[model samples]
Target chain A: MITTRATTRGAAAAVLGSAIALAAGTASAQQPAQSVKLGVVSFLTGPAAGPFGIPARNAAEILIEGLNTGKVPAPYNKVGFGGAKIESKIVDEAGSTAQQVTEYRNLVQRDGVDAIVGYISSGNCLAVTPVAEELKTITVLFDCGTPRIFEEAPRKYVFRATPHATMDSVGAARYIVEKKKNITAYSGINQNYAWGQDSWRDFVLAMKTLAPKATVDKELFPKLFAGEYGAEVSALLTSKSQVIHTSFWNGDLESFIFQSSARGLPQRIPIIMTAGETAVARLGPKMPDGTIIGARGSHGAFFSPDNELNRWFRQAYVDRFGVQPTYPSYHMAQSILGLKAAWEKAAAAKNDARPSVDEVIAAFEGLEFQAPSTTIKMALGKGHQGIGDISYGTYKYNKQKGQPEIVDVVRYPAECVNPPADMTSTAWLEGGMKGAKCK
Target chain B: MTNRSTLIGALAFLVLAAAAPALPPWLISLATIAFAHALVVLGLVIMWRAGLVSFGQALYYAVGAYCVALVSRFTGITDAFVLIVLGGLAAGLLAVLVGFLLARYREIFFAMLSLAMSMILYGVLVKTEALGSTDGFNVAPATFLGYAPEGAMLNLALFWLVLVLSALAAAAIGVYFRSVAGAIAVPVRDNEIRIEFLGLSVNRLIHLKLVIAGILGGVGGALAAMTISHVDPNMAYWTTSGGFVFVTILAGAGSIAAAFVGSFAFEMLRSIAVALLPGAWQLILGSVLLITILFVPDGLGSLFMRKTRGKEGEPA
Candidate 1:
């Protein structure tokens, strides 16, 4: 009986000891999380996929991988966001606004994402903004160009890492007035939507302020994704405008170039496309050499800054994708970098501990960070909207290299192109661009 | 039998409402949207019973949504019930206007004309900058009887509103199915000439159905607008209409409960497909649709009816 009791006591002690050790192991494992889950949304299968969404997605993939593996250069070379690896859930954004809202809710509630970085379509951005705020999710909008997102309402959780369309139009107008001395007449052909309407309006308003002598000839508003531009081209040709401005992008931009070039519209009139940089690589020589292009900011084949970040990002992107990174890719990189900068700043403030969402958001507000293209300033929309220098250049096709290149790049300061923090883009333009601190 | 089924549906709705608080916010939102869209499918089912398929139901849907948006933007009336009623009236009025011409057509002609009308609305909305054009605009948060709620409470309130509205609509539609007008639908589908010979204007009957469908669609759109907190031109696009039609086909026209069940199932399947195959969700959805058509031609609703009939030992 004594021997049996001793054996039972030893067995119970063994079981109790193992249980204690297992509990200790679980506690250690739960103390420090190795990764943070990010919900990355972009159009994966749709018309927007090839030019804008896919490039953005590609950049996100590379950037996330780089950040996780500590392959990124310098300040952004941190091991992910504040030392936690970023595990991304890439979702497709090729659906209706309602559908996107539903998907976004799923990403936050079901997928349990820490932060959201995506949305290429302005409509989708607008739709998801309120939801993001309601959910208190840290959302960084990469490439939606609508100015109304910030101007319409103030937000705490939502931040745009790229400049809105106002910058592109204002910069294009400045480039046009400076380069083309004798501007007799100008016309615009923008899609009949908010982005198009806003772009055209800003461009026209900027022209009114800069070149008051320029006369408006013919303004045509085509439906979005209207691939056939025969009538539009005919109208442009007949109008004989010295300059033609268009904000067409993706399939519409490509289709317009093909159709307009076939009719020799570019040979007769010098065209200014604010969003032309997106199509340069694909169009190659098909895009007329003298055509003016704006990269929204200092992005794409245009004059992005020659810095270490740019050098590393451009080379890595080219190596991975067999093509140079476009403006969308740059935008995506900047958004991720912005998020990383905020996360690190918050963590540093908290003594190298994992910061909460509120802490990160507080750190992100009005935070200026370096991007491959330009220095991104959270200068507008109550420190939720980003501002960056925009550049315009003339498109050139190199025969020897067999590639499309931008030449004669003219960069505009962010303050010169974007509205002041206190004013809306429309109000600023209508007020003759008061308080514009152009250098 | 009808009373028994109605009682069962009421009991089911009560159970769902009581259980809603225990559900996650995402599931609640998803259910709200599903129930809202089910109203549109219910309208489709109404028309389907009479051998009519209005491919442009999104016309009413958009009209209803835009009405709520415009009213909220301009009038500053955040009352959910009022906005929904106004939305239904606007869409119902539009239906009355379009029904005059639409009631004369049948089959593909009816479908194409409806599509053309919705496209016209889409083009107009896309051009009208005041309404935010193709980018659309956001709708203000809704209130119930002057009681303002925010955040999760707001979501819960909206879900409850949608549930109650859906249940009421289902019950009312159930009653309509037994009435002389609703009972004449299958007869009209089988022999329009016979119905006309029986001293009834078939065109007028179809017009009534159209108006009823229009109101239902509008109510659905308004609820959806409130839930989504935004509206765009895509709401009026043919693809939106196609989705409603797809749900209708999936639900079948056998019973009213089928609309809600089918819509919920469709939404759940879509969410699952999206989660599992983000890059190829459309492919998965297409496959499911193909499978359903090949195997369950009468729709998922028929299965429920068959099961109920087996248990009750009565014809469904």
Candidate 2:
């Protein structure tokens, strides 16, 4: 019975192999016009919905439409991959990481999607990576900013379209050290989660290098979504640090800003926010001027808008959503464009046929392309992660107009902030930032 | 009707196991998650009968899940059965230590204490960098004995295993219900003074109930971790424990069958609510709970019972 089973399995493998070969040959012949199903995962409803998730989901919808209709600007003007249509299935990413895993499996196994995009929570992105690899589905993470996804476990089928948490912290530190040279000491208040913790560590390390004599006056890590910061603000104020760095976003960031600003924390010390761009419009007049902020990279308002891609993307997004595109929108557009570029390249390499997962992944490796926000270089970790520039700017609010805008923007090249392709974030940071290029 | 409950449970088991392969991967996963939660609900059913409601059952759940996760990471043991039992035993051991103190408290004090215990674990997990901090860590795929199933087959195997485990748990607990100690749980609730005067140690009985509930909660958490392939500090959050309590209230804690039925129904309703009204899903669930509490009183389980048989009678 064992021998028979082995022989039957061998025969089945042979049939599967030949079937793949035949399909691969005909797939090109029937190419140039097929539908590539993509599962778009982002938070649709929950506390995270208002700021982080909804914008990304909106961008996914708009970007998918653009790709399908060939409405996007040059270089990404093709109707999906190699002249095929892109049809997407949107899924909510508000629940537990486990729930997202189930959704990922559902997308690949049940719905038969060609790829998966969108995950704002670093936890969700990390949780779905192994499953994505196991399913052999190409997954381009839109936002999730954890470096662990690449350094902890590198896989072929998964790629991060945006910069990790390292860039945000390092860029913020560089801006503080170079631009805000008067500051000799600083304190931080970050959410007590992985993203917050990792950002804090990186910021501290980068600051240690950039300003070795600068002292950390105080540090506080409040629980995630712990809105009240009465005691924390008091501690930060009492510490008398010249700067206060925080990585809070969405409701958490809004609450911290409202609570701390009310108590004159911002007035007392300059605040450095790693993910404060999206909060500017909502915070409006409430957001105090001179608060340093960054959108992880040249995202949101800090992007170079003179380019064709940026102009068209920002216009199309505003026209569709009736609101200005946020940093999440930029990240989502980059992911979709990357996916399209890889699939199209693979298709071209394969003689105009639909490329297999391996072929697409091969095409994606070391692939450099232009995005609406900036030029993305897939030069990290053998092309599994994107390395690009990050911009840090000071918030300037116009109280009369009730608007908040970023000013005095300083851009840090990806090579300077992010670790080299062969090194981990901690390893790179611990090595005193060797071989980093600075402008 | 009481006598026929076993038959009903057996039939349900057969129906589910037989149809599991034909179901979609998502549904199979959904069912697995529902059944895992049902185990916690069953544990709550035991405590409810004794007039005890733990607001921190997530303590045991998280303990179980973390046990499985840690074991798999450290020892590379991926056997689902072994991991589940390890989770149960770990939780049970902790309950034994805590129950000594917990059994003496009642009502809000008991709830608060349990909640505190779970929160303590959540705090520890959130701070532990080796365990991935607040983001937690992914669990390795589980194997069945030496056989490793992948993709759809893996889902099917987990479903069948969960089905078998749930049925066995129900049967075993049903027998325990007929035991003197188990049957006394309700009377202990009705008149603790009278039962204490009747030569029974109230504290001992309560402690027993705690251990039983803890083990069941642990098993549920372990199965969920394996099914979902990820674990985080949220498992020990007060809200996670609140979900278990919600299921128990909806099920009424009358019969073991209510645990499975109510949990499955809850999952179905929640999925529908999430799909139909994304913004108001929580509002919709809250409204449904409000309506059920106001109208049904004793929950959906009471509807299946025949009132003619009076108190302590079997379900229809």
Candidate 3:
């Protein structure tokens, strides 16, 4: 089952005739002309900029630069049906659900964008979905993990380049089932949003399947981006569970760790933070050491013989931005490259012309592409959502990056965990997931 | 009252109402918000007439907005008719509760303490994302009875909706002034003991006035939420409560219709100023507020009133 599931998001990119948004007077007049403007929504400033905004900036700058510099591959420069070159204009989607909607409108109506990119927060992605559908443009998300996005709309013009990290809940539960067979009870303190809710749900279901003996002690929903957890931390500390799981991130998670460590939450239950990898690099020492940590992408971190692509990317990013990119930046690099791969693949498949968005999406269905992170494979499922490699990592200090990276990360190939698209919760539960210890 | 003042008030309201439907989407939104805020301020003008400034106005406003949100989210009763009633009823109940505590206080204590009441609701909303946290709830598209509102027609319908509600609220206050209760409620501000000795319950009158004020404020909030289809925690913030107070002070206690005019002026000025200056519009508003409060303490509403009253109104 694991082997079969790993290959579900089998193809990363490339389809028949996809068209990217194009800018005015950029590349509208050529062989096969197709024109459109893409609205790029990302946090250009604010707390999320370090993780989210910069990566988006890098993707837009690099991709557009690639196109403008004549470095773009064949078909892309050749023009398409509408005589439009892919033009992406960026807008600041900083703060709140309401602000995102405003920026989305400005991009769609004011800037005249036909496609969209971005959404660091799963909640933001949810907010933008209705508008995207109303505008009838392909919205490709780079770094959001709420599984509900896929469930709510399957064939809609939305695509997710990154697979869910919450699948690690299964990986974590699987490890616990095999490693610590006896520890059973658990409690969850999560941000009150879809991502937090699902992270806990998956872990709970997975643990419940592995060992029926496990018990859930308490569930607390602190406000997302709370940046403070005094009350929730106190509640969790008193709950008395053998295990604790949280998926707090950015300043919110960091602030929680700072407060929790002071209250000695680490002294009691083993804390399993799904987004712990994102925290360690910035707050390694501050993070309560030995807290059960798993990077959703990689269980633990490890660096192998430097791949040429990885090295090139690292150098290029540092050369341009003066800093090595993080997971967000790396994920963005992969997402943009994905479009490129689709353009190349579509051209080769057809008369070698600029591709349409439908063609790109078609190319993306069951496609695989290599990235600095891993060989990404995509399974176009419900809502055009795809699943691929979900890696896991534990905290370890890396001096050069000057933070703790997920050490000894395990790359979970698209098998064993992720089910087929039509597999219902009940069907998946009945198969190898019964008697699981969720806590 | 001079015919010119009445004529100007009527003309201003009509022009605003008419231009509202023709304006661009952004300007319409801005003017609509201003009008809603102005409606609430009109109720505050009644309280201010009694020399009592209540800052706890957001209590009713949020109650109304949330009532609409709660009913809309929890049930299928999303018609504008039902939502307006729910907003008014919810705000009325909260007013009944807050008015009890507010009855005893006057002057700065009443204003300060009233602000506290609105702040309590804000705290709860900021902490609860299920209620949309600080981001607030997305007002799903609303219907007006069996007729669905959309496009410029929707804006026109909403404008008429505001006009009808504003007129009803203003007319209710007008009728209240002619009654024994409204007269006595004003005396509670000048001499509470004197009014009590006159064999009327002064606190009771204050409570009724507060409830009326709350309903007006709530109706304003509900209308706002319907027009925007988005509500946030800031709607309940003390700053919002303060904005209503500022508007009422600017409008004075000249007439209920003054609320509509004051709000229209504030909104139009704000929109044009904002479009021209962008971020510095707040500076322009602050200056206008400062100058108005300093030079025209009676409020922008008193512009409709003559320089002095002809009749020696009873002090008690």
Candidate 4:
């Protein structure tokens, strides 16, 4: 026992010695200046992978490759970030927020990525935002729609290249108020998380201002990624709500649609899924007709603008991946495009030299760029959060085409849907959307 | 632990602390997290020695983490030392309360009950919207002796804090291992009746062990929250508890040093694996565990024993 104890101590000492040696040996590898390296994080191997991560990843792969080879159409056709090859280190964001924070550090410190452009989970975005500011890396958040990130605190390095949840909720409420007159009661079945909670809150608040007579009943917040919703479906069915508002995304969105449709819940009450657009292509005829769906913005199937960038992105994306690029794909594409725009603008100001992190951030702020989903305006969150026209439409599964289609698409201008830069979404909604510029 | 082992542990801590400035920010961050988690594994090792595996160590972990985050957020207490103590106390208090009910149970019952307690915390945290629900709030940056650090300096400071706390916890645990109560853990595991016949309450010993483990787990979570600068309900999830148990098994309960070494190895391996193969890192980790279990049944720590036995001309 004495010998064994001695051995343990000796072994432990040896381990510690080796750890120090290893740390000294593995100094930060020199980053190659030939290509613009980016760390792209998304859920690649979880329940979220099927609907959200995979599509977003696919879009990133094709878009980055297109940028590298300069195969993309004009404006974004500049080869990479001002003539440099685009390289990406794709990471799976399937773990805890702590894990994501660690990976974010690894990307910035060890791998020496120029910028990071991913994160579908709102929790992850929130966690990584402060870390990005600390590391002084240009991070473009593609998806994760929690408005609290910018509202809670101001950020210098972190930029969201998509509208927050407020747009989705307000747009959904506006569409409902305009289309469905004299709606007495509505219910909600959102995921019990930041994204879901904020979406429900904003929608309810917007409804209070827009349609004061509408009352909310039977608000159910099921756990996120709770695949089985037998109880939730039963509750929604019995609630007798004129409309059901939900903001469930990824697998949860599809699962709810399938289970609830099976019980004929959607047939009774029109379901307003603010994040429903991602599931439409996958669900097809399974998605109940007349279900009001929003793509979170004028994105994916709801993106109606016929522009050169959209034409090329849609075609290239379809050719690479068999399925049409969903909302996540569009969001990912727009984020990368936004980064590219900032990188190029910064480089141009420096006479085509590689711009520093601060230089790129300067170019990115309050910058308006054309995305595949129309124009993206850095209007809110002090020009760090992107806002654009958000569109909602009724789901119409075309038996003739054997694909899901969105019809009667109503687009709300960015200023109309999003709060002003100075005001929070809550304050704006409560104040009856004062100073809202609607076209 | 003997004087020599304690000296070696202190030497290890010094080496890590001195080397922190030279290491990259990522490595420093990874080491800080590894050391924090090592504290939790240290607690697990203590329980494992007594043949008591509380699968819900994350209960204390989350409690500690939430206590730090909440206290710091509400009371404007930004000091790392105070928040860590508060975290430890909160978790320790809860452990003392739960220890009474837990002392009577053994083996799977104890594991399950602990797991249930942690899940209860997880459920509550998930339902509580003010705490940010599933998307938990961020932790304010910690201050050391009223001197606040930012950027790389902050990372280095946090690393040092974690290292120092870890060293102190390890030294204290080492002393405890030499105590009469700690020395009887194996006997309690082997024959509880004999331990009871020895005029000592086995239940009380187990309860004491539970409290010690709980405090260590809480301290670990508190440090982790400060280092990561965020706290979420997942800290209390079964997976987090399982991770601590996994490290304890991998490190072995034979030596206190094994906990730190094993945890550091686990974190390093995971970071490298994730970097090398982002898609199949879990597969690589599982393979390593399978190989470790099959070849080194006692754990990575037993490999040292084998070396010592070989030198002493014991049965190969």
Candidate 5:
């Protein structure tokens, strides 16, 4: 009984017991009954909600549920923000930018939320940034796609958890050039707004660099929320462009797909959609097979399937919402996880006292974490912007699964698609892949 | 009795302004926007009383907003008074030019024509990159008489400015209502031929009304831009025009106070609807409108006027 093995085993057990007890004591001591209040802004009840916004809101709800209960898997485990429970106030992001601005102020000043998360529209994103700074509230922009947010303005208290739309455009163009051949001509039909115009511009610029031989033709800019594409489809058909692209999302995308599919436009030309993943569930059987699609990043159906985290997230999402997680879901998950990690880091640094806004923001700088879809790196835009690799694939309707699945997937690293930290997107693209790394 | 009513209106204005400091920022901001929108409704009320609804009042609203934005951006002008006046003038000039063609139409044709004119501006705004396209852009912070204010002070200053301007507009409109041209607008609505037979140029009178309404709409829009510090083509969209029309219908074109009351009530109800039932605000608004149309017909204004008539034994 007193042999060397027995003695060493006893000593190890004692050390483990003491360590566990100490950790428990520290956790209990650090976390009071107080909770972290978060204002969750999203298109909860609007036309945008069904496809582009509701999934994200659902993911936020489920993810926060898990976090508050300490059921989230490793790395996101432990109670919310160093053992404090998370309480969220959900606000619907309907109406105009002005309405959003007022709601944002209300959420901060009236609601007294510690932080605010969510904004699907780029216009709303641009509108809230300065106000966020003025109030010095920790704000995380979950899914606004304007690059102008970081560039052309100085930011201190604001951060974007999703890559700008430029990455999506550049990534889509690269996918086309690399995967498809015989793309003789390029054309586009985008919403007539900043997001649409910027997407079209970036795609064109990238295509010129990647596929210079592809002649440009048949460009159309339909008004946002136009709800009809018969005329636009007719123009595209008449032009007969070999390759077609669109940045339509949510209801607009569904309407376009519905209208264009009836006219058999997809079969005639190789159609690529920058934000096609949004409509996958709604247009499942209706969407034709082999339609090239992208999810803005390694999100939606075009994600890393090998990771256990991805598997868990996708399964949980489908089980809860009864639909496959779209890019919006992935984005929402990434933001919450990223925010939890940052808060934990700050809490640990402060010996488990509640972290100040500055402390949290400082902790957020250059933060990196493994997300459900991909590894998100706060690598660009002064560490206020998250960058992740882009994923693209062709839609193939799986009869057995009764859903549209992505096939022939292509992946591009964040560095390849997103501009470097020191350069703006337009400047970086203009420089012709000067420092980009692609494989 | 008229003087007493005016005094009561003044008292209400002072009380609201004084309570602003105690009220929450959200309410104050909401009030500012509601009052600004009230200006648009005031103009709509004028046209509505004449039975000439301009479905594209957003054209002038957007023009006013853009004028404020452009003047500030290009000239570095931050004075609220100067920018607002410039906004009114810019929209007024455009209205004067377009009114010639718009005044020539009536009924559905008039509404459609106005909508078309507004859409043209929307199209132009969407295509123009310098105006930030559909995303639009923000206006600089407004300063009051060379005194810069921030946060609560800024809110207070804007509130006072809006209040003073609104009261002045209401008073002036009240006077105009008592004038011959204003008095004949309703008659023109009843029978244009009769008004013409009375030696009044029906077209000329309508042209004047259009200009007046356009100027009011422009001023409202300019004030809106300052209060919100933003502008977009949505301001000129048909839906925006529809909103003004909706407020006009809900408030009725019975009195000037109705415009303010209706707009304020709409904003308050919207805020409450957004809070209690975020997705079903439109449904609630529709229900209210349906009830109003079925029961009152003349709107909330008619209700107040009814009460006054009941007490006084005649229409106030």
Candidate 6:
């Protein structure tokens, strides 16, 4: 009977030990989720890599890690901010509409992500905007050139890091106007999407407004990335356009450059790629010098000696990612910085360590922050998106590095070009280009 | 397989179909997609019943999508019901026209030719800028008999419509399968000489089957376009057709009920895969597909029936 009692005690002790171990495990998880969920949507794997897609991803990754390590202070040190280590979920849209729709649904409904970043294609962003609105999630669009993003008038939750495609074209037009050449018969070989169509329409409008003498010869809107462009190229050659501008990027851009160069189209006419800072260096000897382009902003290249943020951001980017940061990378970095600034403000006002979306939104009202591109001030005076630097520039190849950098970079200020709360950028541009200036 | 049981089952199926709309919204949306596509699967099975396998039903599917894009985008008609009919009619007419060429071929030839036709549509969508090229066109917010489908009401209405269409399709196919004419179609594969000697028009029968399949494919594409409220060029691409083929194979050529179940299962699995491992969802699905094909050649429908039959019969 005594031995039986001892065995019961022994079993109880074993049970108690196992329970303690389980409790300890539950308590002291080494990888506790102080980790905030970040869902990044980019064209990571497919044809969109070289242009806005990869750069956006590179920026998000570098910025996220930096913010996590307390090296960068934007998202972490925001006004009402508490440090939350961000764990990222990345998706690649292989340039397919169905896949993109599926990806957007997954990002919102399943991931339960705190916020979203990076949407490289304008068509993709337009498709996802409804989902974002429906889900009521905060999204920082690193790059999607559609004017429709703002034209449709976004909720307070959605913010864009880049200028509208129309404004991008306006910047390009400004540069073209400065050249002082009678560019007769400008032809456009643009991809048939919101960005390309919007840019073409806006550029023509701006060019007509500024230089009415220039007539558009041929406007070729090809399917974005179908791999064969011989027919389109041949048609363009026969058409009478002194200047030919394209908005193709990544593999499509690479193919076009190689094809056109081989076909001797480059020697005959001026070829301006509206995508100012794609993986231009990767194109190597093929990309000609001085191709006109636009960016999330021109601040990716810190040419000015006075700006400290530019210097620091560029240095930090080079240190973090081996490559000099592209326009989209800088754009994404700026968005995180914007979020951090607002969060810190909210925190300071509430005297609480963590701030919610409403507090952050309040803080974002009329808050100005310096980024690599230019200074962006979020003005809630009109209850619409009033942030971002409308910076544009031209690409010049650095032969030593064999990479292209934005030269003759023109940074458009908020007062000069950003739309008023009452009117869209299109309406504002329509109202006689009044306050619009070139840096 | 018996006539008495088939009639009873069909009647019971009709009675239960009334309760289909009570499920969750996502489930219904997915099921609606399945039911609509199940009609298409029934077409594939009808072809399979005649002893032919097709890998390129996407050709007619593409025709249906392009019809929607053309009518809605160019004409600016927002009536969902009318637009769906228009899409179906457009696809059917095209199919009947293309059927002349397709009916002449058999087996792999028909499959390859159908694929070639889909590729042609893909080319047109990618090359023509007036049609927005490969970016395609978006369906404007639609009105179903003047009722806007923008919210929960839309889902309910769509569910009901899908249910009605599915039942009608089942009844039609069931009646056809039971008919004397339908019985003769089987001999087209098994005893061509006997069928020929019997003075039946073999090519005409094949052509009729193609037309029926084409109509069903068109209806599925139209329903899909309505559900998403967006359409693009890739809808016509061979991959889109491949997905439908995969669904038909996965569900097997059994009861129409299996189509709804299979589509729901596929959607759930895809969603789960997307959630757990966002990057490898496709790979995971592909692997499962391979496994399913190898283990269950008769498809998911056969499994449940076989198991039930085994339990009722004598034990091993």
Candidate 1 lDDT at B283 equals 94
Q: Per-residue alpha-carbon lDDT of model 4 for B91-197, expressed as tens digits?
A: 99999999999989999999999999999999999888888888899999999889999989998998998888888888888789889999999999999999999
Across A1-439, the per-residue lDDT of candidate 3 in tens digits comes to 2332222212101100111121122234332335546566667666777656766577566655555444444433433212246666666555444345545554554455656778876657766665565555667777876555565445456777676644667776665565457876778888765567667777887777777898988988876677888888788878867778787777888788788889888767667776666566557667665565654553122322256656655666667877555666656656666655555576567776656667766776666776555655675364265455554444545567766544444555555456556654434645755333233
Model 1, range B76-161, lDDT digits (tens) per residue? 99899999999999999999999999999999999999999999999999888877787899999999999999988899999999
Each model's RMSD to truth, in Å? 8.7, 8.7, 12.0, 3.2, 13.1, 8.6
What's the true lDDT of residue B226 in model 1?
Answer: 98
lDDT of 1 at B12: 90
Model 2 lDDT at residue B22: 72
TM-score of 3: 0.71
Worst 10 residues of 5 chain A by lDDT: A23-32
DockQ of 2: 0.20
**Of 1 and 3, the candidate ranking higher by TM-score:** 1
Error of 2 at B216 (Å): 0.8
What is the overall TM-score of model 5 with all chains considered together?
Answer: 0.92
Write down the worst ten-residue block by lDDT for model 4 chain A: A19-28
Interface RMSD, per-candidate values to 1 decimal:
12.3, 12.2, 17.3, 3.7, 18.1, 10.8
Best by DockQ: 4
Q: Candidate 4 on A185-249: residue-level lDDT in tens?
A: 99999987777888898999999988898899889998878889999899888896899999887
Compare the candidates by TM-score and give the number of the best one.
4
For residue A44, what is the lDDT in candidate 2?
A: 82
Sort all candidates by DockQ, best to worst.
4, 1, 2, 5, 6, 3
Superposed model 5: Cα runs more than 4 Å off: A1-33, A238-240, A262-264, A399-403
lDDT string, candidate 3, B1-316, tens digits: 4455446556766777777655544445445566777778877887887778887787787788778877888896779888988898889888988889998788999999988888888777766745645535456667888888665566567767777677567666777877898866567777889988989887788888888889988988887777656666667777777777767766678777677767766655543333234324567667767766765656665543433342335231
- Clash pairs detected, candidate 2: A28-A353
- DockQ (C-alpha) of model 6? 0.11
Model 4: pairs clashing at backbone N, Cα or C within 3 Å: none
lDDT of 1 by residue, A1-439 (tens): 3354344346335534643453344234432366888999998998889888899999999999999999999898889988899999899998788889998998887667889999999899999999999999999999999899999999999999899988898899899989987887899999888889989999999999999999899999998898999999999999968889999999999899999999999989989998888888878889997899877889864678888889989988999999989999999999999999999999999798999999999999999999998999999999999999999988888999998888888888889999999999999999998887778
Which residue segments of model 4 deviate by more than 4 Å? A1-29, B310-316
Task: Give candidate 2's fnat, 2 decimals.
Answer: 0.40
Better of 3 and 6 by TM-score: 6
